[model samples]
Structures are given as structure tokens and as C-alpha cells.
Target chain A: EDQVTQSPEALRLQEGESSSLNCSYTVSGLRGLFWYRQDPGKGPEFLFTLYSAGEEKEKERLKATLTKKESFLHITAPKPEDSATYLCAVSRGGRSNDYKLSFGAGTTVTVRA
Target chain B: GAGVSQSPRYKVAKRGQDVALRCDPISGHVSLFWYQQALGQGPEFLTYFQNEAQLDKSGLPSDRFFAERPEGSVSTLKIQRTQQEDSAVYLCASSFATGGNTIYFGEGSWLTVV
Candidate 1:
């Protein structure tokens, strides 16, 4: 079965603190890995998509790196506005549909001023 | 719509009552998806539609859950005989193409079954 797991269910950091969130997955054939940020009462917003192992993408203060079995979302100088639930998802290729994403239980982050 | 939109942002239903949730995808989006999200948990896929055709309903928990996208633009998810276990947020998402990976989501509809 394909599964995705995120470590450190929650994290607290002061403004300007940098940290990384881990997401590990087990899939039949890796196709793509995605990162999203969700705020309360709203749907998730896309951050980045990594297609292959050793691939990386960056946006603003966030960076996403992918490997065969895991992905990391690194935040640099995070601010309170950046506090939100970070989610990681993966898609399986080959005979399986690549459009459907299996997501991990998100890691909630709280950045204090 | 500028983005995906779900109607009835909040709903309270009796245990045996039926409820219908609606989703309007972004204009010209070819793919639509439905997901159920429990509090503190990630969203779980419920169904998928490409245009007006229902492609996958494997993620639906039971037969009582039905979804349809008759016109390939707007969709509805109907739950028959709601149960306490059905209490969660129903999310709707759409993407530019049926086979593309990127999807955009709407603010979910919160359902409370009592």
C-alpha cells in the first residue's frame, strides 16, 4: 500500500527561526511529490512539486527537496505569517494513475513574533 | 469562479437526515475531485471526475456516498442517512486538465452529523 508520513506533528519557532519538516513515503512508483500550506478555515495552497529524486524547488522562504523515499520542506527565517499546516503528498506512476495524490497528515507550525 | 467554490460552508444534520454538498470548479477546469477531511487529519480522496464522466469513486467509504458532475463544471456530493462518523469537512478541488497533477482546492464545507 502507498502511504505518506510526516514527522514532528507540530513545531514552534520564533520569528526568523529556520527549520525543516520531513515527509516519508512508500509508493509503487514515484511520480511526483507536492508541498502545500493550509491556513485555518481555508483550503491548501500549492507550494512546490518535485518530480524525481534529487530534485528541488524553492518559493519565497520555503524550499522543497525530494528523494526516492522522502521529501523535506525547509523554511528559512520563518515569520508568524508563515505559520500554517504544511502538507506533503505523492503520486504513483506506471500502471497507477499519476494524477491522484496520497497526502500525509500535515505538520502544524507556529511562528511567534 | 475565480477559484473552486463550495456551498453551505457549514451544515448541521441529524443522524438520519440526508445532506447535499455542492462544488463549483474554476471555469474550463477539466478535472474535479472530492475529499473528506477529519479534524487534525489530512484530506482523503473520495472521488474523481474528468469532464462529465465519473472516473473513480473508489475512495468513497460506502455506497451511501454518491457524487456527480453532470455538466463537467459543477458537482455535488450527496450523503444518504448521515452518521456521526460522517462528520467532517468535505473538500472539492479542480485542475486544468484531467491527467495533470496540480489541483486547486476550495474552502471546504464543514458537516456536523449529530
Candidate 2:
């Protein structure tokens, strides 16, 4: 079975503070790793997708990096608007389970001005 | 139209009643998905559709939970004899191609079974 685990269930940061969130997983064959941002009442918004170890993607203040065992979402000089729950999901390469994503219990971030 | 769209942003149902939720994927998106999210938790996969074909439904909690994408563009998820545990936000997502693509989600339908 594929399992995803995220660290630091919650985070609090001041404006301009930089930090990172972690997502570690164990899978038979890792097809992809995804990062999403979700607000209180809305669904998750896609952030980035990392396919292989050493892959990275960036957008605005967020950067996502992947390793064989884990992935990281780094927030640089975050503002209050950057506050949201960060979710990590994985898709495994298998005949029957490749279509669905396995998600981790997300990390809720709060940035205060 | 612009993104994945879901109907009935909020719903409250009594136990033993039935409810249905609808999802319209983005234009030209070939893959659609349904997920259930409990309070303060990440979304859990419920089912998947590829061009109207229900390819995977292994994550559905029970037989009472059913989903269909009849026309390959819009999908409906129905719950029969809803229980209190069924209370959660049901999210619909779509991707242009398949599993490896970025999936965009709609504002979920919040279902509260009491």
C-alpha cells in the first residue's frame, strides 16, 4: 500500500518569514507527486507536479522539490495572502491504482502581518 | 466552463435520505475524479472516470456510494441511505490528459448528513 506523511501539522509565520513543508511517501512505483493549496471553504488549487527525484518547480513565492523518499514545498518571504493548507498527493504507477491519488493529512499554514 | 464546476455548494440531509451531487469537468478534459474530504483533512479519492468509463472505484467506502459520468463531461455522485459519517466535502477535479497531468478542482459541495 502507498502511504503519504506530512510533517508539522500546523505552522505559524510572520510576514516575510520563510519556511518549508515536508511530504514523505512510500510507494511501489512513484509516478508523480503533486502540491496543492486549499483555502478554508474551497477545493484544492494545483501548485506543482514533480515527476522524478531532483525535479523542482516554482511559482511566485512557492517552490517544490522532490527526492526519492520525500518532497518539500518551500515558501519564501511569504505574505498573509500566502496562508493556506498545503496538501501533498502521490500517484503510483500500477495497472489498477494509477488513476487515483493518495493524499496526506495537510499542513495548515497561518501567516500574520 | 472555465474550470471544474460543482453544483449545490452546500447541502444538509437527514439520515436515511438520499442525495446527489453533480460535477462538470473543464472543457476538453478527458479525466475526471471525485474525492471526499473530512474536516481539516486532505481529500481522499473516491472514484475516477476516463471518458465516461468508470475505470476505478476502489476507494468508495461502500456499495451505497455510487458515481456516474454518463456523457463523459458531467458526473454525478449519489449516496443512498446517507449516514452521519457521510458528512464531508465532495470535490470534483479534472485534468487535460491523464494521471500525470495537473488536476484542477472546483469549490466542493459540502454535504452534512445529520
Candidate 3:
């Protein structure tokens, strides 16, 4: 069975503090890993997509890196407004018509001023 | 060229009632998806559509859940005989193609089964 697990269910960080979230997966074949940020009462907003090990992508203050079995989302100098639930998902195999994704339980981050 | 959009940002339905949620994908998008999210959990895949074809409905929890995309641009998710366990946020997303790695999502429709 394909499964995704995210560590640290919830985290509280002070403004300007930096932290990292982890996402690990077990699948028959690796295809793509995705990161999303979701705000309260809204759908997830896409952050990045890593297709291969050793690949990384960054946007704003967030950086996502991928390996053979896991992915990491690093937040640099996070602010209160940056607080949101971060989700990680993985597609079972290489890109195909059946691009089904299994997602982790997400890590909630709260940045206080 | 707006992003995906879902109707009735919030809906409250009584148990045993049937409800329909709608999703309008971005213009020209070929792939559309539906997901169900319980509070505090990540969204779970429910179904997938490519153009007017329903490709995958394996993730749907039960037979009560049915989704259709007749015209290929707008889609609807119908839940029959809603139960309290059916309560969740329904999310809709669309991408340029069925195999695209990046997908854009709508604000989602929150459903409450009373």
C-alpha cells in the first residue's frame, strides 16, 4: 500500500523563527511529490512539485527538497502571516493517465508575534 | 482566466437528504479532480476526470458518492442520503492536462450534515 506520513502534527513558532517539516512516503514506484499550504476555510495552494531525488524548489520564504523516500519543507524567518497547514502528497508511480495522489495528514504551523 | 471555483461556499444538509456540489475549473483546463477533507486532515482524493471522461473513481468512499463532468469544464459531485459521516470539505482542482504535476484548487465547499 502507498502511504504518506508527515512528522510533527503541529508546531508553534515565534515570529522570525525558522523550522522544517518532514514528509515520508512508502510506494511501489516514485513519481512526484507535492507540497501545499492551506489556510483556514480555503483549499490548498500549490507550493512545489519535486519529481526526483536530490531535487529542490523554493518560493518566497519556503523551500521544498526531495529524496528517494521523503521530502522536507523548510521555512525561513517565518512570519505570523505565514502560518498555515502544510500538506505533502505523492503519486504512486511515474507520470501517467492515472495520476492518483495519496496525501499525508499535514503539519499545522502557528507563528505568533 | 480565473482559478477553479466552487459553488455554495458553505452548505448545511439534514441527514438523509441529497446534496449536489458544483465545480468550475479554469478555462481550457483538461483535468479536474475532487477530494474530501475532514477537519484537521489533508484532502483525500475522491475522483478524477479528463475532459468529459471519468477516469478514476476508486477513492470514493461509497456508492453514495457520484461525480459527473458532462461538458468537460464544469463538474458536479452528488451525495445521496447524506449521513453525519459524510460531512467534510469538498475540494475541486484543475490542471492544464491530465498528467500535469501542478494543480490549482478552488476555495472548497464546506458541507455540514445535521
Candidate 4:
């Protein structure tokens, strides 16, 4: 069965501290890997999309890299406002009609100022 | 609206009662989806709609769960005889016609079955 797993169910980081979140997947025909940031009571906001191994993308303070079996989201000196649940999702590689995402239980990061 | 929108941000239903959640996708978006998210867990796919056609409903938990996107626009997810286990945030998402496109999510409707 296809599976997506994220490590460190919860992370507490001091302001300006850095950390990494992991998302491992065992799915066939990996089409895309996605990263999202979600705040309490709000839906997830798009962060990055990596299509293949060794691909990387960066935002203001977050960087996401993908490999064949897993993906990592690195936070660089995160701030209190950066604290939120980071989610990783993957979609099967197939026809254009197959667009559903399989997600892992997200990692909740709390950055204290 | 500028983004995907959902109605009845919160709902509380008695067990055995029915509830309906509404979703208005971004204007002109070709694909719409519904997901259920339990507390402390990630969103799980429930169904997908490509225009007015219901393309995928396999992820739906049970036959009591029904979704529709008639007229190729606004959509609704209806749960019959709500159960306590049905309590979760129902999320609606939309994307372009092509595959691998970024799927945008709405604020989500929080349903609590008592």
C-alpha cells in the first residue's frame, strides 16, 4: 500500500532556531511532492512543489528538497510567526485526471519568541 | 471571491441528523475536491469533481456521504445520519484542469456531531 509518513509529530523551537521536518513516502509512480503550511483554524497555504529527486525549492525562510523515498523541509532561523503545522503530500503519477493527494500526519512546529 | 470559499465555517449536528457543507471554488477552476481532516491528522481525500461530473468518489467513507457539483460550479457535500465519528473539518479544494497543478484549499467547515 502507498504510504506517507512524517517524523517529529511535534517540534518546539526557540525563536531564531532552526530545524528540519521529514516526510517519507513508499508510493509507486511518484508524480509530485508538496509542502504546505497551515495555521490553527485555517486551511493550508501552498509552499512548494517538487517533481523529482534532487529538486529543491525555497521560500522566505523555508526550503524543501525531495528524494526518491523522502522529502525534507528545512527552516532557517524561524520566527514565532513561522510556527505552524507543516504538511507533506504526494500524488500518484498517472493520467491528468488522477489529481488526489495522499498526505501524511503533519508535523506541528511551535516557535517561542 | 479571490480564492476558494466555503460556507458554514462551523456546524454542530445531533447524531442521526443530516448536514450539508457548501464550497464555492475559485472562479473558472476546473477541478474541485473534498477532504476530511480529523484533529491532529492530515486531510484525507473524500471525492473529486471535474466540472459537473463526479470523477472520483472512492475516498468517501460510506454510502451515507454524498457530494455534488452540478452546473460545473458550486459544490456541496451532504452527510446523512451524522455520526460522532463524522466530526471533522471538511475541506474543499480547487485546481486547474491539468494534472499536477497546485490545489488551493478553502478555510474548511468544522463539523461536530454530538
lDDT of 1 by residue, A10-112 (tens): 9999999999999999998887788989999899888888888999898999999988889999999999999999998887886348668889999999999
Tens digit of lDDT per residue, candidate 3, span A1-113? 78899999999999999999999999877778889999999899998988889999999899999999899999999999999999998877755533777889999999999
lDDT of 2 by residue, A1-113 (tens): 78999988999999999999999999889999999999999999998999999999999999999999999999999999999999999999866666678899999999999
**Candidate 4, A75-104: lDDT as tens digits:** 999999998999999998888434989999
- Candidate 4 chain B has its poorest 10 consecutive residues by lDDT at B95-104
Interface RMSD of each candidate, angstroms, one decimal: 1.7, 1.1, 1.7, 0.9
- Choose 3 or 4, whichever is better by TM-score: 4
Could you tell me the C-alpha RMSD of candidate 2 in Å?
1.0
lDDT of 3: 0.91
Q: Listing every candidate in turn, what is its Cα RMSD in Å to the true structure after a full C-alpha superposition?
A: 1.0, 1.0, 1.2, 1.0
Q: In model 3, which regions exceed 4 Å deviation?
A: A94-98
Candidate 4 ranges beyond 4 A from true positions: none
